[model samples]
Target: RAPEEPLHLVLPSDRRLLRIAHAVLEHPDDVRTLEEWADWAGLSPRTVTRLFRYETGSSFAQWRQQARLARALERLASGEAVASVADALGYASVSAFVAMFRRSFGLSPGRYFDTQAVIA
Candidate 1:
């Protein structure tokens, strides 16, 4: 039989923060507060806040927003409509989503992909 593929590995230094990252990836659409994430991680809110920064070099809110942006990028790349991707990613409106996309990527979604096409 073929050998099994290796499982994803996390270094000891990163394991503590993996839980938070997994939670964010699993439910990017949910607008839970940091306190909720803290409670779910079985940590005090302040500890979660501090450790998240230490491990990820970003505040929990920023990390979560990045995760949401990553999800939006995937959907947009797959040719999903911008309005549908915006709503599914939990933006209040398409304009809000476009604003965030521009802020994060320095280009609107259409232009972002257009640039990628040129680079490719």
Candidate 2:
């Protein structure tokens, strides 16, 4: 079976949820927890988690990772080195970043352009 796609591509059905998501996007690398997001959105943590799944079809943590990955892709595409990108994105280490990137895209950041070239 094909891997399930990331849910950031899916729009949130609730306007309030969308606003919360936008706030999260403003600082995707800040390492904030769901509780923090809930406070920022003026909702309870449980409600925030439920709303994320209901409106965005992903858990809050999953959505955050997707947001961070999206930013990572942009930085990497602009010629940032993998280790530096990892640090800038608040990853514990470069290996962790590579692992997450591989899981998300099925290719390490180092090989992403190579794979694109082959596909083209």
Name the runs in model 1 displaced over 4 angstroms: 1-17
How accurate locally is residue 120 in candidate 2, as Cα lDDT from 0 to 100? Answer: 71
Over the stretch 1-120, how does candidate 2's per-residue lDDT look in tens digits?
A: 544546354557676678777766776667778887678778899998898898777888888888888888788878888998899888888999999999988889878767666767
For model 1, state the Cα shift of residue 54 in Å: 0.8
The residue-by-residue lDDT of candidate 1 on 26-86, one tens digit each, is 7777777888877777778898778877766777777778778878878999999999998
Sliding window of 10 residues with minimal summed lDDT for model 1: 3-12
Residue clash pairs of candidate 2: none
